[model samples]
Structure formats: structure tokens, C-alpha cells
Target: MPEKRRPGGNTGVWWRLIQTAARAGEDMFVAPDARSVHRGNRRAPRTEVFRPCLVGRPGGDPDREIWEGIVLDLNRYGFRIRSFAPFVEGDLVTVQLMRDEEFKYPLSGVLTARVVRRSEAGGGLMDFGMELVVEPLSPTSRSGRGIRPAPPPSLSRPGTRMHLADYISKGRGNKNR
Candidate 1:
């Protein structure tokens, strides 16, 4: 009979290589003074969900193909999405909400969002931090089908991110200088 290895037992020669690679997500320090630090400035609380959805450009560009992605976390203002395609900053995307993995039913026509942050999650996949860029459609348009309207001047076309404070300031007729 073969002996069973313990939980921490080394599998083989690649043990060191695998161990070092796995520490990336586990080693970020939140201490303000740390050389490598992490910060959480989110204003809205989020719900963690593993829902599938379709992502692509607005207006259904014929040349660009829509792709599938998983919503990692969602909140009122934004959500974090993981996809195989790498989206550039300032790129506007439309998310087609799906009922589930069966791909049989559609939940909503499309939600407009801007890619505020992007990071490589390895394995040719990427993680995107998206900010909802438009207001919800009126109840009359709530059949779960409506294209995104034109972006407001302050919200779109900015290479820099629009912080929550910026939004509040914009409401008071102040420009982000």
C-alpha cells in the first residue's frame, strides 16, 4: 500500500516555486508605514457574488467581440469584474446581466461603466475595477432593454479617475482642477 502524504508534505521539486508564487495575495500589508501597503477607500459596502455576465463596448460594435466575465463583488456605485480580456483605463463598457450560467435569460439590457483600474490576475486573465457611469433608466424603460445614453461631460473623457469627492464637488458646480 502507498503511504498518504500529510497536508503540509512537499509534493515535489516545484514546491518552492509554487510556495513563493502563492504569497502575492497573502502578503499585502495594511499598515500605513509599510513599504508595500494596501488601502481601502471604498465609500459603499459591497456584496460578494459569483454571477456571470457579458462585457463589451457600447452600441454593439461589429468588429469587437463581447466576452464573458464573472462579477466578484458588487455595490451600489461599482463592481469588480474578472475577465480574460484586458480593458484599458477610460474604456467604457456595457455589461449585459445574465440570469445565471445557463445563459438562457437576460436580466437587463446593459449597464454602462468605466474601467477605473485594471490588474493582471495571471493565466491570461485580468481584474477590473469598474465605476458605474450612468443613472438607471426610468421605470418606463425597465423592460431590461435599453442602450446607454450619452455620457455627461464631467463623467467621461477624463484620463484621471473621478473620485467620490469629485462627484460631490461637481454637483456644487465646481470643476476638478
Candidate 2:
């Protein structure tokens, strides 16, 4: 009669057999080429570019409120804005990107961004790279009721800074600067 192997003895033999089989498989395996590895992989979804614009802070100092920026790049997840102003490392700011003026509302999203890196652009312009913490505002929000009116043509342009003194002097009881 064949002797039945105990649990410990059987386990040791089983482990040795698994190691031997794995070693044999490794020895016979061939490394795949980088290009071939991605042959059947599905392509990533394409991301559309949105034209970014300035959004005023509701109650912030008008001088430093409107930031000149552009949506450098974007995905469904988040976007990167190139701005002249230096935002702190972890500032919660409201960002707006322009869409069709007639029907499509502006893209407004609240992002908690961290200053990932900062570099100097020529002409004393400071560029900040921020990593967003919050999910971008949905398209529905832009189309919803209570959409704010677009800013004037002059303020809409990039690189426009209205100092506090300038704002007070130009105040005609109108929100448009």
C-alpha cells in the first residue's frame, strides 16, 4: 500500500514542484518587444482643448481678482492653466474657460490646486504649473440658470491688470471694468 504524505511533507514537496515549474517556465519564456506589447491595447481617449478666460473673484480685491490665464491642456479629469499671477501652493480658486457666447455658457470649475512648479516667462511673466485636487465642474453647471454675464472685450484680453486705485477711479457703479 502506498503511504499517505503528511500535510507538512506534502506542502514542502508541492512548494518544490511549484518552484521547479516556475523556473522551467522562466527558462522557456521569451521577452516581448515593446511595440508588440501594445499591439492589441486600446488607444487612450482623446482630450479636447477648451479656451480658458478670466473669472473674477466674487468678493476679492478687484485689483488682484481677475487673473489672465489659458487652458494650456485638459482632460476629463482636470486641466492645467498658464497664468501670470503667482497662486499659492494650495489655493482654492475659481477657473473659467470660454465657450460659445450665445448658447454655450462659460466653463466654470472650482479647483484646489497646488503649485507644482513655477518658472519665469520672458517679459517678467511668471508661469505656474498647478496640480488640481477637485474634480472639474461639469458641463451642466455652465448651462444651468444664473450664468453670469461675460466680461467686457478689454478685460477679456490676456495680460490686463486693473490695480485697486485704477478700479476706484474708474468706478461708475458698473461691474464691467
Candidate 3:
């Protein structure tokens, strides 16, 4: 004969009690506050997420020496970067968006980010997920449309190596120490 399955197994009493409480409209457990709920929220704005990106560290030259990285996800608040090199927590970085190829121009922004989590998929490959503590460049505010023009070939030229230092020095007058 086939074995029979019980209607309730472990914690049946607990489940019954929970159902009773729910039916009574007296919450057995309190709901978390807005702040607590927000803490667990991982959803970001559409614009910040799923946008193509290139990430690199700051270097001496403002125009060169930035290691390129692809942005896997982004939000208005922060972004997740995928790069060969690992980024430590609290590291500052600059992100560039390739808007268009015809113009060969890139919309760039600078922000300070801290590494929140690191996942390794083997073969010396690591994915760095960071949270942006500082605000990134707002393309909308600068041009009044919030949309950026095409990226310049100068920014994404093939075989071009622009160090983070070059960009910093030229744009912010800051040099890597």
C-alpha cells in the first residue's frame, strides 16, 4: 500500500495559532517601521539600474590610466560594477556612461563609493557590488534634459589607456598621491 501523508506535520500547532491570530486581526508580530523596511529594500530607480558603464580608479593623469569596468546594474542611489580588479570598501571611483557613438562623447560623473559585498565566481574573477555614499554626476541637471549626448571616441577609443590620474587632474585638479 502507498504511504499516507498527514495533513499537518511539524509545527502544525504553530501554524494554527498564526492563522487564528491573523483571523482575529491582532497581529502576533509587529510590522517593521519604514526605516527598517527601507533598509531591506534593494530596488533602485530605473535610470540608475541596467545602464552601460565603464569604471576606473583615479590616477595622476585626468585623461588617462583608468581601468575599464562594465556596470551590471545601477540606480539613482548607487550601482554595481563588474571589473577584473577588486575594489575595496570605501573606495572612491568615477563612472562614465557611453550615451551615443555618433558624437563620440561620454557623460562622466565622479562619486565616492564603498564596497558592500564581494562575490567570487572562481578563475580569479571577482564581482564588486558597491553603494554610492556620494552623489554621482546628474546628466539631467547639467543639460536641463537629464539625457546625455553620445560618448566621444576620445573617451572610448580602442587601445586607448586613460589612467584615473589623468581624468582627476584635468577635471578636478586632484592628483593621485
Candidate 4:
């Protein structure tokens, strides 16, 4: 067997090479690329828009303690969020989306996900990266069939009933409609 090399033994060499190459590239009047280096590695495209949401731990008092957040970006398999609540790595949480009626895509569902990464995002907020915990239905490759629809906004709030006519009237005066 070949001799096994230890990790981190030559870390500085790689850094030096990168720095020198970057300096050389800059000297050649090359413009810095605006695209991310990870562009080609993503499973799906992400929209750079914020969607309102509520995130909470399973079986917790969602009305009393649920943290409001914005879904920063999402792909086919995972999502990133900026939340008021702190989530530890490996915690399972349910994400409920607050739909915007003006948007063309109708978002309705509670997705169960495992928190794979978390970091402090300043101002007592946190950033989380969660992977969807979808269970395959059978021996075949059908996935994500187990996702459940989110609870209605009326249920989220206690003793508040919304009328459909009231909702429709609010949009009548808006120019976007």
C-alpha cells in the first residue's frame, strides 16, 4: 500500500499559490468575475427574493413561540433562511410559508427539514441551511410525496376569522392587480 499523507501538512502552500495567482491575474487588468464559483454546482436555480414564513420546532407552541423568518433562497432539495430564532445543527423543524397573493406561484405547505448548518447573522438573528427530510414512498425513486399542506393562517392565529369578501375587496384598489 502507498504511504498515507497527513492532512494540513501543506495548507500554506495552496494559499500562497492562490494569492500569487490572484495578484498576477489582477496585474493583467482582468476584471473580477461577478458569477459565483459555486454556480455550476447547485442542483437548481435560486430566486433572490424574500418570502415571509414561520419556523418552529415540532410539537412546540407555534402561536406563542414560533419565530418569523424570511426564506432567502431555496432549491429543489434545500433552503436557506434568515430567522429570528436560533436553530442548532441536526434539529428537525417545520417551515410554514406565508403566501403572497400577488405572486404567480402558490406556495402552500409545511416542509419537514433537518438543520444541517447554522450561523450567527447579527442583531440576535440566525442563518440556517436545512435539508428537506423527504421519505421515499417505495423501493422506487418517488420522493417528496409525503409533504403536508400548511395550516391555514386562520388556524395559526387564535380566534381570528378572515372573510373571503374582505380579502377580495382589499385588492380591488391596488394597481398591481
**For this target, which candidate reaches the highest lDDT against the unseen true structure?**
1
Q: Model 4 RMSD to the real structure?
A: 23.5
Residue-level lDDT tens digits of model 1 in 22-99: 554333234547453343335666788888889898885588878899889888888889998668999999987789
Clashing pairs in 1: none
Highest TM-score, which number? Answer: 1
Per-residue lDDT of 51-77 in model 3, one digit per residue for the tens? 445666766577854555556666666
Candidate 2 segments exceeding 4 Å error: 1-50, 55-64, 100-105, 109-112, 135-177
Off by over 4 Å in 3: 1-39, 43-51, 59-64, 100-104, 135-177
How does residue 101 of candidate 1 score in lDDT? 90
Candidate 4 matches the true fold with a TM-score of: 0.49
lDDT of 4 at 160: 73
TM-score of each: 0.54, 0.37, 0.42, 0.49
Clashes of 4: 0
Whole-model lDDT, candidate 4?
0.72
1 or 2, greater by lDDT: 1
User: Going through the candidates in order, what is the number of backbone clashes in each?
Assistant: 0, 0, 32, 0
Error of 2 at 14 (Å): 36
Order candidates by lDDT, high to low. 1, 4, 3, 2
lDDT of 2 at 66: 70
TM-score of candidate 2 against the unseen true structure: 0.37
Candidate 3 vs. truth: CA RMSD?
26.5
RMSD vs true structure, all candidates: 22.9, 26.1, 26.5, 23.5
How many backbone collisions does model 1 have? 0
